[model samples]
Target: MSNYTPTKFATALLLSVLLAACGGNDAPAPETPAAEAAGTAVEPTTAEPALDAVEGEPALADAPGGDPAPADPGAPAAAMPADAAGLVAGRDYEEIPGGKPLEPLNGKIEVVEVFNYVCPACAAFQPLVNSWKARLPADVRFTYVPAAFGPRWDPYVRAYYAAEAMGIAERTHDAVFNALHIERTLKGERGEDSPAEIGAFYAKHGVDAKQFASTMASFAVDSKYNRAKQFIVRSQANSTPTMIVNGKYRIKGTSFENMLENTSAMIARVRAQGSAAE
Candidate 1:
């Protein structure tokens, strides 16, 4: 695990990556001529806080852990009906070559969401993801990985790590989203909030501001944040609100609702495999 210490050079590199990812400010770009002609608004791929991609270029194949294993030829059949709703590997999801969850699961299947608090799409998807998570069986484990695309997003990532360390992540997670998206009190753009400012926000939810600030800069938080970056890279999830199931498959769907449905099917498939193994 790399201990994160912000050097002038590293900070500058991160900021450069951020600028490249967004092309500029946080506003959503206007639809292109082709998109308008097609009668569909072209959702900005990296425009605005929520729509932006991760920092640095995508390097999924070179990520640590190597490539994910090939699909098991003798694998048990998926439990879901092989109908339209059924997830088709490579079509609805891609297997990670060396993809594995951040933490080992003693026996439970792992489901992870790679997201950013500043992302508008993530804010929109939060309630849906939350509802799905609440209904997960005990045999399935769910966790979140906050995206650290650049210096602008570093504070939010630090805030998340600090909250998790303080055991207040769950309590304050939704509140953070609401603060950014609903209330519009917290600006999602980079450089909008200092560590001190973010600490004050957490203080409202019972976290000590001073401790939060200290923790955000601690070696432990840095390690966690670094691990999160690796996970995002390995998952090959370029956009916000992407899901990975069992660290093996990156779920894909035409729409948000489709993605959730696909996720449910994938969870069922993994559960079935575990049961069969037993």
Candidate 2:
């Protein structure tokens, strides 16, 4: 973690975002009529400690590899069903101010998932997001931004960046979620795992222990973490599994499935705008 401490203003801003997010006390009521209407199961809210653990064991580093290549962006977008029409802005999604730009700006619309590895809601939403990503058109790009809510959450974010730097993120991303939610090996509470222990988890996935440790602390990983944190703040993403389309709209589906449906519509919406602009 950067020795850099959050300033009072930054901390206040993050707290405000968190309080406004789903995990907060004022979070939306589960099993709302909208969710039932969408035929979606509501995820239960639990009052566990704020911290969650990372999953996996560390192993010796093998040969270095390149970053995971972007998925093919040329496929045609899937069509939205008739029922997916009229997704309202405030109800179904919210628009961001001064929209964020796509990273690497590959001339395609971007979809960003701001999530945390330790969030149970995020874990539950992963498969759905994965399926949605698979169907994305060639003109759309998808990426994940791990949230850093506090010190307890910092290590997992570091782990994500480390794996990315070592080129193992694509292969091991789901495994980390399984470790936390299924295997129950990684804990989220403070002081559960040292940097070395966390490094061991990645090492088990073929990330060299020493190299993983070095990379986790390296300037490169730090830069990525900083960027992710900024994105979360700028996007005002207070909840896990939050989806942003072209960095202009924040999607809010009544149900998990509905969220994906809304995501599809937003992508189409953005694609149309891009075409019109050209």
**Pairs with backbone N, CA or C atoms under 3 Å apart (clashes), candidate 1:** 50-119, 50-120, 67-97, 67-98, 68-96, 68-97, 68-98
**Tens-place lDDT digits, model 1, residues 16-44:** 33343456646432112232112133331
RMSD of each: 11.7, 16.6
TM-score of each: 0.71, 0.69
lDDT of 2 at 269: 73
Candidate with the greatest lDDT versus the true structure:
1
Per TM-score, the best of the predicted structures is 1
Instruction: Supply the global lDDT for candidate 2.
Output: 0.64
